[model samples]
Target: MSPRQTLTSLIVGLVLPSMAAVAAGKCERLVVTGSPDAPPYLWRDPQDPKHLMGANADLLKEAATQMGVKVELLFAGKRSQALEEVRSGRMDLLADTPLNTGELESLDFIHPPIAQNEIMVWTRVGHAQPFNSLAELSGHAGAMSEKTRVTPTFENTIKEHLTLAKQPNLTQAFQQLMLGQAEFVLAGRYAGLALTQTLGMSKDLQAQPLPVDTPGLYLALSFNSACNDPWLRGQLAKKMTELAASGRSSEAVARNLELWKAQLQQPASTPNQ
Candidate 1:
């Protein structure tokens, strides 16, 4: 072959593969899912039942906006279903993933978690007890929603040092506390407070000022996601860091907490008599 022809072929070979790599790495959009019942973090939009709306959803949107990407936060059944969707790569992101060692195999967690989940202790008003640390609840019988997840180490500590019951939902867990079936209910501060107001239990129950555990709330991408590339991850991490430093993360949380309250106050629709 001629030297000129061989050089031309080599140039084409390198350029084509480079172009393909760029195309493969492009991430224009992402599909996200998370706990549908986690309020102020995420919850199903009552008006638009198919999508999720709350602090985490809003914050993620803001981050994606900065990266010039469109994000859809959808409600995919329960929290377990949402996790599975991300794990299977059917969904690109999990908005409020807790740090889990086991999940490391299937997911890539972004650094500087988006938020800290304050798992507080809630007890009936008149029954309030001193709660400075998790160790204080050693003998007391506690309850928490089955869907709530703490760190694996914390879970092991609970098993070895605490007596806790897992209930179907936060309301049931709080009910157990109020009925004297359980001493205290462990739950996310905002999530528990939201339920208290909606259930009209705020007057009867109160959350302790101290949290039992504060776990990092992260944004994770599935290993199988088509858009799971270093460029996308770096952009998202940079956006998250900026949001945290700008105090916008706290503002989003406050806004969503109020938004959830207003949504609950809206009168339910009725059929014509």
Candidate 2:
């Protein structure tokens, strides 16, 4: 072959394999999980309990799509169980979860977070009162989902000062407040709003205007994930950070709320296969 043709062929052989290696570094398949009842953020698909859907799901799907990866969102029972699945490496990705020690050890958290969750107080309609801060919550019984985690500062003090009840899930926590069994319930602002609508409890409860804590919700990658390579983590983090900074996450949240609103109106006629 001519020297020019030989040089071109040599360059193609070298460059193409490097490109292939870089592409192969990405995670091809991702199994993501999230809360089964937390809406706006994530929740089990009503028609298919084993699958999940919501804002976080939407964001993850788009991010995974951008990376040419396939995403499978599953519901592994309750929140704690879902977390355990991720921790145990049974799941590759956790779409919406908070930062904590246990998770920190087993997972690589992507930032900036997909969404900022502002937790607030919820009470029965007529029983609602001015709640400016957690200090104002003293002497009142508070309820929150057993799966929910509070900030270190809030937990340190709230644990010692308040009679906070941990219900099995969001529905139960809100139910406790509505039944007068608890004076106030702690939950996410958008999630709470979405829950009330979905559960048909909008007229029965009220959330205080002030937030208790503003925590960012992240997409966590399990340390043992099959797709937990540097390329996967870096790409996912970059996409998630863009979504967070560009307000795409917020827009997705608003869009997902409407999706949930529509889902709430649908009749349950289909079952998961």
Candidate 3:
């Protein structure tokens, strides 16, 4: 490892003891909630429908392990309800969310992002050109999931120029695109890939080379969290920074992508009688 990497490793190694002391004094465990529909990052655990599992879960479990604190990701409800639970202090942490000034009042955001993902436009294999920007799709009718969140800037830009076809999720948005109901579908790169492959439509879809939006997924600690103090925040920041520099988040995404793909490859089992 390089000198910088070595230093990071050392810092990370030393974090747990300090964190353990602080956690012992203030908090016992952390309750986290995340969006269950977002695949590759987080989704409902198949074994236990009420819990979450995926790359985000993997990462959170590792982080909690490093911090010497117990963490449980509960299915509080849908995305909106989950956010409400975190905001009201019924939950301690939220797995992933965008950094918005509006949320700062109730949440303490870690600086480095926990994960990063991109929203890209998908078109029929040969239909997509050497795409570069959203402006390239100016007059084409684009499809998107209403559940997908884009920056306000991108949203306004799309509204002004693109004929967007909104659907409930990436799978349906791509369905619309493939059937010629829409020219393109705006969806997350990894999530879209998994959904298209799961739907057995990967051969027909192509994600545009350029991204419409590239947002870093943040882990926000509720302001009401008992561990949402200076020490906890600082320690979490250090760990996050180390993870980012080490490319752990990216690796987690890639690892989960293969897992998702493997699931699609499995034969359909009989439904419960």
Candidate 4:
């Protein structure tokens, strides 16, 4: 072929593939699943129907934007449903899950924990005596979410006293506590506090630090995701490191805490306790 004809062919091949790649990128989408019940972590605001606004949601959105990906939020009915979505490849990512869920076998997690969640004992104020250890609560009624995983240390011990409440959300559990249906509820500190306030039960209940379980939460990707691109995980990991180093992560957590405190009408000093 003539030199001019060969140059024209090379230009066409490069430009066509470049345009095709641009089109393909536009079609790529990220689907995230979360439940509205996990306040301070994942919750739905009536003002924003399409958006789930919370600490975990904000962090995931920031990470996605930083990686130049488009995100779509899906509301799963429960934690179990969300996990099923990830396992079935219906959801691409699950943000803010405790490490003990045994989810690692079906998902790849970003390094560096997203947050530390403490499992605290919530009881009606002046109703039950505070206990220093789980053993002290033996034979007393306790409430726990269905299929919830506690650390092995407390799992067996608490199981003996667990009442197996069927409440769908933390707010409901708090309501149960107020009505004398449950002696105490087991939940994360941030979430339990948020629900107690939102449901107008803050004055009726209080949470004490328990010697239960605590675990690091992580952003995880479904193993069956169509885009199992290792680079995406690397990018997210890098962004998380940057956020932590810049103290942005801490600021975000503090901001969320403040919001929850205000919603609960509780004193900011309560966080220190």
lDDT (tens digit, per residue) of candidate 3 on 139-254: 87778887776776787888898888788666677778778998888888987887777777889897877787987778899988776877667777888888888888889999
Identify the runs in model 3 with alpha carbons over 4 angstroms from their true place.
Answer: 1-24, 128-130, 264-273
How much is 26 displaced in model 2, in angstroms?
A: 2.3
TM-score winner between 1 and 4, please give it. Answer: 1
The full ranking of all candidates by lDDT, starting with the best, is 1, 2, 3, 4
Give the local distance difference test score of model 4: 0.69
Q: Is candidate 2 or candidate 3 better by TM-score?
A: 3
Clashes of each: 0, 0, 0, 0
Better-scoring candidate (lDDT), 1 or 3? 1
Error of 3 at 258 (Å): 2.5
Cα RMSD (angstroms) for every candidate in the order listed: 4.1, 4.1, 9.3, 6.1
Compute the lDDT of residue 245 as modeled in candidate 1: 93
Backbone clashes in model 4, listed as residue pairs: none
Poorly placed runs, candidate 1 (over 4 Å): 1-20, 126-128, 267-273
**lDDT (CA) per prediction:** 0.86, 0.81, 0.80, 0.69
Model 4 earns a TM-score of 0.71
Q: Is candidate 1 or candidate 3 better by TM-score?
A: 1
Give lDDT tens digits, candidate 2, residues 1-273: 999999999999999999998777767788889777667788788778789998889888888888889999999988788888988889988888877666688889887788778888888887746667777889888888865656667778777888898877787887777778989888878767877777788999888888888777788888888788888888888897778678888888899888777776678522110
* lDDT preference between candidates 2 and 3, better one: 2
